[model samples]
Target: MSLKGVELQIAIPKTFDAGKMADQHHQKTINQQLDANEALNREIERKQLAVNKSEGMDAISEEDENDASNNGQTSSEQNKKKKQQQEQDAQHPFKGNLFDFSG
Candidate 1:
């Protein structure tokens, strides 16, 4: 018998671990679900922030309008006070004509 013509045969058994595969599949599904939930939460927070920003802008505009109206009223009241002062000055021309030098 020559060494080049000699051959050896060996038997090896193949096995499948079903439980380990199932556990791996289950963990993959759980990770996917967690990722989806995180994405959904981020979307909800973004929409809520947008709504709050819009509401804040609306409140600021309303306050500006009220301030404008109040300013108009204040100007009218100032005009009335000036007219009253002018009438009083006309009635008593010498009331404030002399300055008090004693102070």
Candidate 2:
């Protein structure tokens, strides 16, 4: 209600609920923790696989390091290492969510 031509503004605050705010904060923290744990798990798994492969290659049927020597040098080791390096270089240097539109 206005008296004459003067108007009055109310100072009432907006209907803010304290419980919902706390719940939202809790959910945000949980999500962040979950994301961090997932990243840690993936990194651990990758490292484990690398360790296993290195250990498991010991008994494999491959040219011995000493057998591939030439003039006290190993040509076979060099060639094999070079080939593996090439394969590694051929791998996309990027990890996760790679998209190549230049087909």
Candidate 3:
């Protein structure tokens, strides 16, 4: 017996596109990252505004304090003490001389 000719056929099912799935996942991650960055920027701007408003008030208070200190008697006794300390500091700015400073 001899099998001279035969017709054989094989079919393989198509596989899913792994690369397309990966691309979709990447796009989703990028969108999420962009949203996070925008939110962070908004928060930073809000914090800067708060800091500026507070610093402005602080500067005004310091200016008022400076004006109050021009006279001999200050608005608070603490200011008087600070003035006395400043005068003492002007006379002897450092407890030890520069030659005696280790650091």
Candidate 4:
């Protein structure tokens, strides 16, 4: 029995192109990230608009208070108290001078 003239066949592994698969995966993730960013931006804009609206309402209320104060004596009492506090503060300087070594 001689096997010198016989040829043997073996199974070989096929090579796949990994670069294309990686490129496809990266593109999918990038699109998802962009969509999330857009959603976040829209949310931020909505919150900012709400904040602006509330601040406008606060300004209107402050204006109304000012108008009411003009016809009340409480405003004068408040002004006198504020003036007295200012005078007291002026008379007694800040204790921060303790750190000043420059005589």
Estimate every model's Cα lDDT from 0 to 1.
0.70, 0.66, 0.70, 0.68
Residues 23-88, model 4: lDDT tens digits: 889999999999999999999998877745457787678757756766656777767865886687
Comparing 3 and 4 on TM-score, the stronger one: 3
In model 4, state the lDDT of residue 11.
16
Candidate 4 or 3, higher lDDT = 3
RMSD of 1: 17.1
Once all C-alphas are superposed, what RMSD does model 2 give against the true structure?
A: 13.0
Error of 3 at 87 (Å): 7.8
Candidate 2 per-residue lDDT, tens place, 5-59, comes to: 2222222222234566878999999999999999999999988777454644763
Clashing pairs in 1: none
Error of 3 at 57 (Å): 3.5
Q: Estimate the TM-score of every prediction.
A: 0.40, 0.37, 0.39, 0.39
All-Cα superposition RMSD per candidate: 17.1, 13.0, 9.1, 9.2
Stronger candidate by lDDT (1 vs 2) = 1
Ranked candidates (lDDT, high to low): 1, 3, 4, 2
The best candidate in terms of TM-score = 1
Q: For model 3, how does the per-residue alpha-carbon lDDT over 6-89 read when each residue is reduced to its tens digit?
A: 421211111235666788999999999999999999999988777454567876797578677766664686677768867875
